[model samples]
Each structure stands twice: as structure tokens, then as C-alpha cells.
Target: MATIPEPANATVQAVYRLHEQRDAQAGHRAHLGASLIGHPCTRYLWLTWRWAHKEAFDGRMLRLFEAGRQFEARIVAELRAIGVQVSEVDANGRQWRVNDHGGHFGGSLDGAALGLPEAPATWHVLEFKTHNAKSFADLKAKGVQAAKPMHWAQMQTYMGLTGMDRAMYIAENKDTSELYSERVAFDPVEFERLRARALQIIESPEPPPRISNDPAWWQCKTCAMHPICHGEQAPLVNCRTCAHSTPVMDGAGGWRCERHNTAIDTGRQHSGCAGHRYIPLLLERIAEKVDAWDEPGGNAAVRYRMADGAEFVNGAPPHFSSVEIRAAKHKAMLADPQVQRIKADFPDARMVA
Candidate 1:
């Protein structure tokens, strides 16, 4: 066998430079949009582009993300138990690297499971999904209907990057206490077709259209740029009398406006309405409209209404009685110098109706 020399730093640098050039030429963000969601709608594509570059997770959220990693570990263990030889490769330095031309498509597998014995080596790329049973059931009931285009494209892209013939999704539904697995195979022809579409979306000046097929309401809630992509609506403000209003759970927790107080079943678990209400103020300063009304028992209320049909109300206390005023006036009249000084401290007040 002939000895081969390790590549020099100059070669590695050249490779990296090439990768950057390809990424820039392909419009990497738009490429990401196409590969993930198969949609190039300007808003959706741009939102996805921004999300791919965002680092909004905190330490607490990172800890929660480790749960999925643990699940992946368990799935690896299971694959090893089934007599499959598993090993991780330094994919970044690997030779025979798969190139998509755009440089926006590549991923290193966690580990590749290879078959033994008489059968040809079957490369397996495993993906682990950990969720409560409710979520699993919802996805199952929807039958890929609820699956995000990005998710599907992600798995497919992995297969392409790794040159794997097949991939598996091992899902553990913690709530249902059940484990499920699904196998997916790569279709080179289909992969090429998708890749072309993605490239076209990336090169085009316009965005792709909104996917009308998605039925999952949860997606709408968690999306970061939802307010910008979606339209503005009502803002939720806390109120003492409204049933939807609740006290803040902790000192650190902000006050729960009425919009957030509604029960989950009532579709109020998230504060979209309240958050949307402030969109105009956040995006641009606008003059607010005010409306006033009188209430029974000499009380009054002021309403600050926004163009979006959202309102904030403040109520006034009842007026003082005539007898009460008369007694106070008499006491002030009969006061000593010191008492008179005290009475003077309490300036006369008038009810403004």
C-alpha cells in the first residue's frame, strides 16, 4: 500500500475559503430557507433565515435541550445492542466529502451504524425525537400533515450529506411511555429535485409562498418573528375585575395581563394578543385614542383605545357624600391654630365629573 501525506494548513485554508465563496454565491440564508421549509416566501424565508442565525437560548433552556441529547444517547445504545457496529467519524476532516455545490448543505452524523455478516454494509443514520405523548399523538394523527417542511428537509439533507442510504427516527414519547421508530430512505432523484428547487428559491429575488397545509397552531405560538410576519392585534393588559387577569406567580414573573389569564382550553395559554397589541408602539410611535364614559354611583371610567380594537381601562372611585364634606368643614372651622395648620395640610379637593 502507498503512504499518503496529511494535507497541509494551506490546503485546509483553501477548502474553507472555497466553502465561504460557495456560501456567499448561493445566498446561504435563502438556501437554508429552501432546504428547511421548501418555502421561499420572502417573509417566511427571511424569518427562517434570521432564526437560523439567532442565539436566544439561555442556560436553563440549554439544560432542557440536553434531554434530547440524552434520548439520542439511549437510541445509540439500542442500536449498539442490536449488533450494529457504530462509530463516529470526524466528518469535518473526512475525505470524499459530499458537495452540494451551494456549500449550504452538509452535516456530520452522530455515528454511522453499519451492518455485518453476509449482508452488504447498510449505513444507518439515526435521529432521536423526545416529546410528551400528546405531541407524538398529535403528529401521528396528522400524518405528516403537521410536520414542518424544515424538519423533513433536515432529515433528508442529513442523508445527502452523509451519503447514507437510510435514516431512522427513534421517538420516545415520555407521556405515553411508548417508543416508536420510523425508517426513511434516500432518493437521489428526489434529492436532486429538491436541491434544484432550493437553489432556485435562493437565487430568486422574491420569497416563497406561505405553506397553507400546516395545521399546527403550536408553530404559530413559538415562532419568534410571528408579530412581524403576522398582523398586529389586541394587547393584553392586567385588570382587577376581569376573570382572565391573574396575579403574577412570583416577584420575578411579570404581571399577567387579562389576555394571558384565560384558561389553556380558551386558547389564551400564550399572550399573542397582548404582545401583538404593542407592535405599533414597538415598530413606530403613534398617537393613541382615548374614550371616557360615566358609570353608576358617580364613578367614571377612561378607555385608551388602539387602532387594533384593543383597549386599556381605568376606573375612578365613587364621589364623596354631602354629609361627610359638611362634617369635615365644621371640624376645620372649630380647629385651634395647630389643628387649623393640620387642616390646611389637607388641601380642599373637588370631584371632577
Candidate 2:
């Protein structure tokens, strides 16, 4: 028999490349948005904030997103056809959004729905999701809260942010077209707990310890940030990831810097500033020696010797270059008297000591 031909590889490659390019152009988000608020691991949330990079979604995953979107549009159309009033986009052609109390966190809702049998003409937050056959069956059997706490928490947060008391959580099965829905009332207690937890993550200086002690744990194997979070790769530079920075009370009921003893604006916190330093955990594998030193006016420094045998006695070096340049810059910063004075004022400042 003649040799069987393979499928066209070029077409699939083109499709995958297009999706990859789109993913790259989207870039990383600066805020810790609502979708991730209910994730199981606090350490994962912290690592996300510290790194701010999305897991690389392959072509199949990207296509799944597109399918979910199409399903959303179809659901909206069906609702409209049934004389239900659902507006996915608001007056300005934008989705509805809400911010947390401190304005440090926020997210856009899917839509608002009205005239459901459960509510009888009252408006409620419309939260929609699509799942596969097995997942949808589980959702139908257990309902949202019992089967999926994350989705339940997300709806509660939406209600909390929008000051609404009710939300209609809808799920559709992609394979079977089966639909399941439940009206979830706002739980102030749950919302408050989630909100407080998110604030704690944003305010804490160091990330919470890893979720597991064993690197070979099942969860670790599936985690997208496994390499960087586990110290296999260098972490991205940011204030939250810095060794010398911690969030303190700003006194007006918001977060401030432990180092500067002042409120750091949101943008600076997200992207980092001139003073960014890699946290000690991230540097441990690469640093040869780290020492603690005290100066006048109650200041302290965690001096480091790079693996290359160069001495540098300061935090917050610029983008890494040759080991020699970074080491020399660190030495320069330590020698400056102004840097000395600046360090002295922050008695609360700390590092790996």
C-alpha cells in the first residue's frame, strides 16, 4: 500500500502562531482582579502579584476562551428571545465594573439580568460560565457552592462590590447544551472574608510560604508559575517582590510603605520603582554571602556577595548586568552618605536577616 499522508502541518502552525502572538500582545495585568480572588492557594495569588505574568495558554486553551465567549453571546440572545431583559454592555457600551473599598482592586462584571422567575422583575448580577459535560453534571448535582466554591465566591464578590443583594449564576454544558442556574444571595460574611484576605496578600511584605513542602507534589506539578515561585528561575522585579519593602498602615485606613513610611501610589507598587530589590529567597541560590550591618540613626543593611566573588552592600540594584557592574553599583550606593541617611530613617526596614 502507498504511504499515508499526514495532515497539513502548516495550517495548524499558522493558527497556533496567531494565538500566541495575540497572547503576547495582551501583556500582563497590573491589578489582582476578581477572577483570581477565590483561587485555592494564597501563595499562588501572592506569586501572581509578585510576578504578574499569565500562564502560557496553548492554542487549545485559547480556543476554549473563544468558545466560551461565543456561548455567552448565544445565552444572551436566548434570554432576549424569551422576553428577559439582559444587558451585557451598559450605557457607554462598556461592561459594568466595581472597585474594592480601597480602590486598590476591581473587576468588570459579565452583565446585569432582569425579569427572571426567581427575582420577578428585579435586576441582578448576571454571572455566566461554560463547562464540559462531566463538570456541568457535577454542577447540576451539587449546585455551585458545593461543587465550585471559587465561582460561588466570585458571585458573592460581585454582589458585594455592586451593592446588590442577589446574583444569578448560570452554567451551560458545551457538549450537551444543558443549562443549570441558581440564584445566590449576597453573603456579607463571605465577601468580607475574601476582601480581607486579598488585602492581606497585597499588604504583606513577603509572599506566603509555598502551599506544599514537597517540590514533587501533584499541585506543584500542575502550577504554571512552578519554576519561578519555587526558585528555579529568577522572579520579576517589583515592590511586592522586593526584600526591603513591606506594606504598613498609611493611617488613613490604607497601606503605606514600611521603608518610606508613606503611602506608595498604585502604579509604583505595580511596576516597581528605582528602589526595587529582589527578595532574599529569590537571591539565596545566587548570593555567596549575606550579612547584616547597622549604621547610625538606627539604619541597617543586608550586604551581599555575588556568586562571582564581587562585593556589593546595598539592595535595589538596577536591571542585572555583568555581575561586576551590579556589584560595583551596590558598593557605590552603600558608600553614599545620602543613602545612609535614607536607610537610617526607616527603622522598620529589613531583609533576610
Candidate 3:
């Protein structure tokens, strides 16, 4: 018999490239996910909620995400195979969802199940996860609560919202194919605390305080929001980060543009209007919006004072536009003392480039 032929290396490369392309086109999630609500950094949460940064996952990372997703389906199937009664979706055939804060904050649950040896008759919120060997070892050594507080918070929120008193967390080790399961009880106090944290993130007009002022903090170093949170980088341009826009303080999960007093759908939010102005705090490191610095979170065009003591406006004729301010973040010429004087003198001129 003839031996089967192996696929060429180019085929493998092509597959990864396709993954990269798909990720490149992926849009950022609109809601603040409940799964991430437990993260200790408030500033990171706010920046993510406000589209202060964009995700640029490489092909390898994208593939890892896909692997974890694939693992979830397998885990569900295996659980059902072992005589466990599992319900992965609600009546609508959609993944069970938990919504709060006017729908601005929520997450989709893995599933619910019954028939575990410890509590055969009771139902449990199901949480599935995949971890590498090192992470798996630590999880076993420390137990879920001590080693994975975020995961603990996640299960608590799910059980509390879904009306379950307990949760089953099952993690698979990628290296050894080892499995670890833990039963977690819901904490009402922790649930309420998580609820309050979500509300605080959704309602506040400005980004929440950073966990540390030091940029070198290890946690800060690994965060996606690192550049904008610590470095001099400006946030991505979008309505969510604009001075005129804000998340509605309700369960509507909607955004509003104060300048126009109109509802902003996700499409319009991604493509901010010409009236856009950077939220005062977003540019605090580069320039200060002198006129509206005292404004809670939103304000119209205003005066700006650069670090070198030059002045300019952010809106109307003679002042730079929001786009220009973002562009200036990249080009030194935009903030040059001489150019500021030129603009001050030409008051009528505009930087079109």
C-alpha cells in the first residue's frame, strides 16, 4: 500500500495567514464583558469599554483562541457523555446570557448541568476552561479560589444572575490532557460587589483610576491598554472616547452624543463625527483642555495649553480639530512651539495635511 502524503509546509503557513486576516477584520466588542468584570484594574476596564485601544492579535494568538473555543465544545460533549444532563442554551436556543447596567455589561455562560457525584440532583452553572501545564499545576496546588480569583468572580456572577447557588468549573490541561474540576458556591456579597463594580465602570464619565502610577508595574506591562494607560500614546479615534459621547446611565446599553443630543448606534460610534473632541483626561499627558478641564466628562470645543506653554483651540475656526489633535500625537510639528505661534498668528489657517 502507498503511504499517505503529508501536506506541504506552505499549507500550514497559509492556514495561519487566514486566521490573521480574519482577526484583523474582527471588530472590538461593544459591551463590557462580565467575564472581564473581575479584572482588578479599573482603568483597563474603562479603556476597553471606551474603545481606547484596538486588538491586534497575531496568527498564533488567534489560533490559540480558536483552540480554546474548540475545547469548550468538546468539554460540553464529554460532560453529556458521562450521563450529565447539560443545557447549553436557553429557550431561545442562544447561549445563556447575563446582562446588567442597562445591558452595557454582560457575558454568555458556558452552560448548566446536573448529575455530579457530589450533588447529583442539584443544577450548577458550568464553566469550562483550558490551561497550559504551568497554569494547571498552580490551579491544582492553590485550588480555584486562591489561584484564579477572576474565574471565581466569573462563576459567582453567573450563578447569582442565573439563579443557581453553585457552579462547576472544569479546566483541561493543554500539555498533559489532564482535567481538574472544582465546585464553587455563590457569594451574595461578592455578587453585589461585582454588580457595583460594573455599574461604576459603565456610569463614570471618565476612565477609572489606574491601578498604579508606575508604568513599569508588571500587571500594567501586560495589559492591552498599556500604551494609552501609561505611555504618552493617545487613544484610538472613536465616539466612545470623544468628549461629546457617553454611555447612557441605564439598562438601555446605549450611547449618546451630547453635542448633537442624539443616540449613537455602534456604527456611528466607530465612525465618530467631525464634531468629535478628545475627552479632557485622554490628552492630559500631551496637552490640557484648559477651558473644559473642570468639565465632568463632556465638553465642546475648547482652549488647549501645550506642555511648552503654547495655546490653541480644539474646535471651530482657527483651532485644530479632534482628528488633528490625534494626528499631532504622532507628529512633533503639531505641538512645536513655533508652529503653535504660526497658528496663533494665522488664526484663520487650518492644517489640512
Candidate 4:
């Protein structure tokens, strides 16, 4: 078991403040990076960088921020309406701090609410989420199936930090104008597991990779590393047996391959090669190809024929396969000219792949 960091102070309010600040900083970075990477797509690191730096915001980003604020305010109002004691609603007590790996981590919470008469005097650590009906439906579907690991881990992390046994997710579905309240309970066993995992992440030299397959286009489309991860000309392999297999168009702009199934017009990018061995040589080859494709008219597209006999155009499947290697396309439309320019200007950009 990894050593978990203890709160600097044992008081509920003290721990709450610390965890709140830490979460706030993390949330800020995550949102900023999500904005830059385009939502649903930005990686943790990208979001962190954008959040650390005060960059200019576009109208769309501004609207997103505004909507978030509005949602937060509404959650506060809901808590107040329920007659729960709301903390940190005022300016002075808004910020909190915690000890993280001997360094300081701080953030702010929306506010804490006490549950109603029917429920225990449980402290509700309220988390506000804004989603369209489609997104909400997706979540509900998953919950019906089984709680997602990430969501479970997230709520557990909050529980461990705040020492609260329960939390609530106040989700607003814009399309249906429906408010969905979901309650989550904390398991000490689960908290211990998450605490150990978080300690590992903090102690390790590298960050943990994002490990969800949520079919949200905004999540990947807005990722900063999408160009490197899912760029049209990126060198990838397709295999029928690999778990990452998805039907995708081949380089020839006709015929589909099962090995390449990941390229379907899902409107979202996903992590390919989940089980891929991180080989330097393979990475180098991919970098070289990305570089060649950056040159003027240097791009090529290949049409791949899949075992299913379906016709596909542009890009290969998400996985690498030993059973198939088909045609290559010289240039695909998805490859952006701006990206090519960036590659041309900074040859080292290939290393990012």
C-alpha cells in the first residue's frame, strides 16, 4: 500500500478547506485545458498547462464558463432551499488548503449542505454538472449498466478528502430542462483503494493515462494532443484480434477494415493501442511519417479493405495488427494545414507523437 498524505489539520472544516482548494486548482486547470483541447478531448496535462497560464478566452469558452457559474449558483440555491447549512457561500471562507506530497494543494467548493429530515444529517458535497440530454442519457445508461470507474473514483476521492460519507451530483440536462440528482455513498474500502492509487500517481514520476472509453465527441475533439494521437496521417496499425480494433476507412478512400474500425464518424477521438507496447522505434517511425505528411503535398491517403467487405474512405483503424497492412493515402483532408506548418517550423513536434 502506498503512503497516503494526511490532512494538515484534523478538523472537518480544515480538511474541507484544504481539499476544496486542491480540487479548485485541479478543476480550473482541467476546464481551461478542456477549453483549449476542445472539451472531452483535452488530456490532464494539457488542461493543467492552460489553467496555470491565463490565456485569452474566446466567446464560446466564455459562454461555457458562464454556464458553469450559473449552474454552481443554482446548486447553492437548491441547497439553501432545502434548509441545509451551506458553508463557503461567502467570500471569506471560500478558499481551503491541504497538504499534498509535502507541497500545498488548495481549492474552493461550491458549498456544503446538510441533508434533510428524511436523511441523516449527512454533509452533501455537491458537484454540479451541465449536460445535454444526450450526455445525460449516456450517463444514465452507464449507471443502469454499472457505475463508471472514473465517476466512482472521482466521488470516492472527494469522500476521502472531505471525510464525508456521501455526496450528490446535481446534473442539469439542458435539452430536457430536467434536473437529475444522484446520490453516492463512500465505501471505506473503496476510499482506501483510491487513496493508495492517488498516492501512487503523486509519487510516480509520470502521470496516469486517461482510461475511459466514454463516447463523447467533445471530450476528444477538443483534446490538445488529438493531432498527435488521431491525426489523419499518423502511422497506426490495425489488427482484427486486438481489443482496440474498430472499423475504419483505409488509405485508398474505399473499402473498410475491421482492424481499422475506430475511424468511424463517431465525431470523437479515442485512445488507440490501449495495450500497445511503447517501443521507441515504432514511435520514431510514426514521427517520421507525421513529418513527411507535413510537407506541401507531402500527405498521402490509403484505402483499406477490411474482412467485412464494407467500403471505407480515409484513415486506418485504431489498433495495430500483424494480420493486415493495406494501402496508404498520400494526403487526407483531416490533416490540417496549420498543423503541417507547425511541424515544418518545429521538426521536434514529431516527438510529441
The number of the candidate with the highest lDDT is: 3
Off by over 4 Å in 2: 1-7, 89-93, 238-276, 283-289, 292-353
Where model 1 places Cα greater than 4 Å from the true spot, the runs are 1-35, 38-42, 50-60, 90-99, 116-120, 138-150, 205-222, 231-353
Q: Write the per-residue lDDT of candidate 4 for residues 140-187, one digit (tens) a residue.
A: 766511433455555555566677777676677777768766777887
Report lDDT per candidate: 0.45, 0.68, 0.83, 0.42
RMSD of each: 22.0, 8.4, 4.4, 19.0
Model 4 residue runs over 4 Å out of place are: 1-58, 89-92, 96-99, 104-107, 117-120, 140-151, 206-223, 228-353
The Cα RMSD of model 2 versus the native structure comes to 8.4
Residue 159's lDDT in candidate 1: 76
Judging by TM-score, tell me the better candidate of 2 and 3: 3
Write the residue-wise lDDT of candidate 1 on 8-62 in tens digits.
Answer: 7777567556655554343222124323544424445533432222324443444
lDDT of 2 by residue, 59-178 (tens): 778988888988888888888898889977777888887766355466778888888877777888888899999899999999998888888888888899878899998899999888
What's the lDDT for residue 154 in model 2? 84
Residue-level lDDT tens digits of model 3 in 7-81: 677787888899998876666788998788889898898888989888788777889989899988999889889
Which window of 10 residues has the lowest lDDT sum in candidate 3? 292-301
TM-score, model 1 to reference: 0.45
